[model samples]
Target: MKITHYLYNAFLIESGDKKLAVDPGGLMFYYFRFSPLIPKSEWNNVTHIFVTHGDPDHYWHADRMAAVSKAPVICNKTMVQEIDGKYLLLGPRDKGVAFTTEFKNHHKLSVDETIEVDGVTITGIKTTHGPLTVKLGPFSKTLNPGRDERIGWGAIGFKIQLDGKTLVNLGDTLLHKDEWESIDSPDVLMIPIGGNAVHNTMDIPEALQAIRIMKPKLVIPCHYNCPAFFSKNFNHADEDEFRNELEAMDIQYAILHKGDSIHV
Candidate 1:
């Protein structure tokens, strides 16, 4: 199996006849310029798409990619609403908390629920996206996750089993030790470690705690040192320090830059 990183939490996992796109989002805050993380060239070949939440950095281009590739999207059940016999997805580009977007092929699962789609098995895992605090100049605003807010709407992780291997991707979430105790010894784990500064996802220390619980073979840290607003490294982290600690713990890890890939 081959895994490719496209910055933030966007990734492409390829094995046999399946190509899975995880969180195929766009670069947020660059309104004048549009930049897609997964790249337009790779859209047509995507077999499936997975979304962890409805944040713009993780879901901006999901509908477009799903439309182009004709791939089924798997997300938390809260992201969709069945109204008038039509399942409407939370609008990827809607103003706020509106289910205006609809995908022809989609699957919604609650936490701890499992589903099989096109020969792949997927299980939804519990997660919580922390409150996001945005700052501009002298003003700051914090958005908390709630029924009416969009900070971390539909936040959930994924445990994907395919080609005789288990891969876990925890999209921007805080540490949920009790909820994630059941996930044991995955082949690969993609976790976020940039929340120390922004208080959104798990920080490096929290991510290490999760690694000890899950005991994955290979760990890939994400959502750190990303571009946002006017800063090139909005969610900053010291990956080298993280690597040293992992080494002391005898855990294998990969620090992937944008467009980097690792084979397992």
Candidate 2:
């Protein structure tokens, strides 16, 4: 199996004759001028695409890529209702915030369901997208007039099993102790280490704690340091800090930059 990173959370997974793409959306947010990341022309081999949520940065290029690759898009049910053939894609949002964008074609999957696409068996795991806020341009403002608000959207993680190996992709999520009970130990674990202090996702310490619980043989950090529009300050998670933590716990991990590929 070979995994290639493309900017933010977008990734290309190649195994034998199958190529799968995860979260192809990049730089589509209204705040950014344009996506710094561009889809490669060679994506013709993609057979399946997985989208963890409806965030623009995660699903922006999904329809475009699917059109070229002729791949089936697997996403949550809300995302399925958001597409009309290929032009307008809509997703459930808080009042005043409607569907985000339109796409060409899409297939929706539900949480806890296992589906086989091409040769891969993927199981959707439950996850939370943290509190929701009213999105305004590049910034988000709390919606509640006076009281603190807790907003959550339907988000999910994935456990992809193929070729006798299991790889887990935990989309944007906070470290929830219950998730450990739902997922089996995987061969490779792709986790987000950027949203730590922000509370939107796991930080370095929380991710390390997750690693200890999941005990995957290999760990890859993702969903951090992409376009400036998505994050005000962008920097790859402190890899050295991660490395030291891994050393103390005796965990093995690999850090890949955009456009880098790993073969396993």
Candidate 3:
């Protein structure tokens, strides 16, 4: 299997003649004015689209990708509503057109539920978004917890099995031990280490602990390094500490830059 990172969490996975796109959203910090990290033409052959959450940066451009590839979108219950959907509407738009999300077929899965397309198996692993924190200039406050997946776009992870390889993408979320217990050891684990004061996803230490528990063969970190102009709580720290720990434990890993691809 081949993996390509396209900024943020957008990843393109190629296996044989099939291609799968995960979290195909924008580089939101750039005000959504620039081109996608991965070009539209590259996505023309996508066979499946998986959205981890409904944030603009996550699913903002899923419709576009789906339209180009004519692929089936697999997402949470909120996106599977199947009714006419409303969206932030990426790219230039005409006034009063009522931008909405529509797909020929949407495969919705709840936590722990698994679906198979062709020969690949896709499972909706448990996940949670960060707490709702209201930031006030130099000060910040936490309003509510983020464990509400019942609300639909609450967030979720995915375990993709193809060609005897297993890869898990733990969207934007904290370490949920209970849910993690359900996930078997994966060949590649994509976790978010960009923990913030508001406690969105696991931080360096927390992510390390998760690594110890899940025990994946290859670990690729995500959810960090939001451009200063694009965020307030994001930490742009280097991965030396993370690497040192992983190296100490002799865990296989790779640090992927935008547009970089690796075989697993």
Candidate 4:
């Protein structure tokens, strides 16, 4: 299998004829102009799309990609709402919390729920998105995910079983040791390590703790050192130290920059 990393938790996993896209998002900050995380060149060939949450950096291009690729999108049930018999999806570019986009081919799953589609087995893993605070000079605003909020709405993790291998992706979430203890070693574990500076996901140490619990064979750290607002490295991490520690534990690790890939 070939796994490609696009900054911010976005990935393209390819095995056989399947081209799966995880969090095919774009840059969240409107002020800065940047290219799409998962470039458009691959959109038409994507076989399936998996969304972990509704964050812009994680979901901005989902609608467009699905429209172009005609791929089935798998996400949390809360992201879609049945209105007048039409299943409207949470708008990726809408102003606030609005279910405006429509995706005809989609599947929704709740925490701990499992579903099979086209020979692929997917299980929803429990996850909790932390409160995110954005600051600009003296003005600051905080958004929290809740029953009526959209900041971190429809948050979930995915345990995908395909090609006789298990891959786990924990999209921007805080550590859930008790809930994730049952998850045995997976071939690949895509985790976030930028929570300290942004207070939105697991930090390096917290991610390390999760690594120990999950015991994944190969670990790929993400959601750090990204471009947001006016900073090029908004969510910084000490990857060198992280690699050293993981290596000390005899764990395999890969630090993929944007546009990098690994084969396993």
Q: RMSD to native for every prediction?
A: 0.9, 4.6, 4.4, 1.1
Q: Which residue pairs does candidate 2 place in steric collision?
A: 82-90, 86-103, 86-104, 88-102, 89-101, 89-102, 132-151, 196-203
Candidate that would win on TM-score:
1
**C-alpha TM-scores of all predictions:** 0.98, 0.82, 0.84, 0.97
CA deviation > 4 Å runs, candidate 2: 28-31, 36-38, 82-106, 132-153, 230-232
Look at candidate 2 and tell me the lDDT of residue 166: 95
What's model 1's TM-score? 0.98
Q: Write model 4 residue lDDT over 1-264, tens digit each, in one string.
A: 999999999999999999999999888683665458998998999999999999889898898999999999999999999998899999997867899999979999998999998778999999889998888889889888887887888999999999999999999899999999999999999999988878899999999999999999999999999988877787789899889989999999889999999999
Candidate 1 — which residues are off by over 4 angstroms? 31-34
Best lDDT among the predictions, by candidate number:
1
Worst 10 residues of 3 by lDDT: 90-99
lDDT of 1: 0.93
Where is the poorest 10-residue window by lDDT in model 4? 27-36
Q: Which regions of candidate 3 are displaced past 4 Å? A: 31-34, 82-99, 132-154, 228-235
Candidate 4: pairs in clash:
none
The model with the greater TM-score, 1 or 3, is 1
Look at candidate 2 and tell me the lDDT of residue 151.
Answer: 30
lDDT of 3 by residue, 168-215 (tens): 998888778766876667999998887755466778888888888889
